[model samples]
Target: MLIVEDLLLLLLDDETGTPAKAGTLPYALGGAVLVELAMLGRIDVEGAGSVLSGPKVVAVGDGPLPDPLLQEAYDEVTRKPRTVQTLLLAIGGDLWKTVTDRLVERGELRRESKRVLGLFRTTQLPSAGTGHEARLRAAIRGALVDGTEPDTRTAAIIALLSGSGALPELRPQLAWSGEVYRRAKELEKGHWGASAVGTAVARTTAAIAAAGAAASAAVITTVTT
Candidate 1:
């Protein structure tokens, strides 16, 4: 499964089977795609310090990314020079639906379309595969609540969620909002705990991704408020 797919699974509400924060989902997914590309060496990020400033992302390959959503993002990056936040906003708006459709095709999510009061149409995705989401939530909880070492994928999700202000939505169930917030700070500081993730991943990249997510969240907050 794609990293964004896993991220989206956690962003989803178990009880309602919809995203907890609709505005933040796209930005989170956009960050996920960039992280995935970085992990694969398909893209390169350059900056002067641990935190990205005047950072530039360039594609490493000549062809399209295997996933169309990712391909579109790649195209956008190549089309111009943009900071991580700019790229996230430029490509983020559509990632939620793109990833959702990809999930529907994978049979992990079942699509539901209906008319609201028989007037306007709406679409929803109910969990078709429960086991995956269960594992995802458990891993996140383990990282935040139980102090278990999280893998790179899990760490990325937690960082993105926390940065985007979406992690608190789970406080009603997990009751670990304080821990979650604390762990997010650690992740932002380039601590991935005692895991392979720490050795394999760079702190600067995590900071950049988190910054992008936080910037996107700020934009959303501004628009709504």
Candidate 2:
């Protein structure tokens, strides 16, 4: 929803103390926008929350460094200049594999073969870099705005409709159904704060709908006359 997006943008701007560019805006604002839309019944809040809080692990090589070798290497490197071959032989095959795997994943180290010797022989190091946060933000924004995919566009529309209070009321007949009640309870718990703000939004939506219905009835009556 535009309102939710605007609010998120405002929050990010406040936090950063400046208007964020498109590149930076997505990372800072995407989570808030997704959360707000979920609160408004436009998106799956649970799924979004899970993605934001998923487990992450940082690997150093193919596996953990052997404790004895690691300690010795640390001391030796700090005290004397050792050759790469010397360090590899001292660290051993298993630890080196782990280290190589980790390096490849992070784009820091490359691998030519699955073999430990191959890992040691290949020696191209990637440059240190940062900017993934900006890319993530851009991707989220693109998914919302670009109508290329039907599912994404539909999600965007649902978010817009729900945030704008345009969704049809949960029918009384269906309200107490198991799924309905469960979802409602979940939403109530998750969106307690938003619900307080939503009272004003609901009232405004109701007033506008009522006014439109009345105007339509008047027009119909005049046409009949």
Count of clashing residue pairs in every prediction:
0, 10
Give one digit per residue, the lDDT tens place, for model 1 in 133-175. Answer: 7788888888888888888777777777776777777522555
- Per-model TM against the reference: 0.82, 0.19
Clashing pairs in 1: none
List the global CA lDDT of all models.
Answer: 0.70, 0.29
Error of 1 at 223 (Å): 3.1
Model 2 scores what on Cα lDDT? 0.29
Of the candidates shown, which would achieve the greatest TM-score relative to the real structure?
A: 1
Per-residue C-alpha lDDT of model 2 across residues 115-219, encoded as one tens digit per residue: 455555433333222343233334333333342222222223223222222222211111134543333232222222332344432332222222222333444
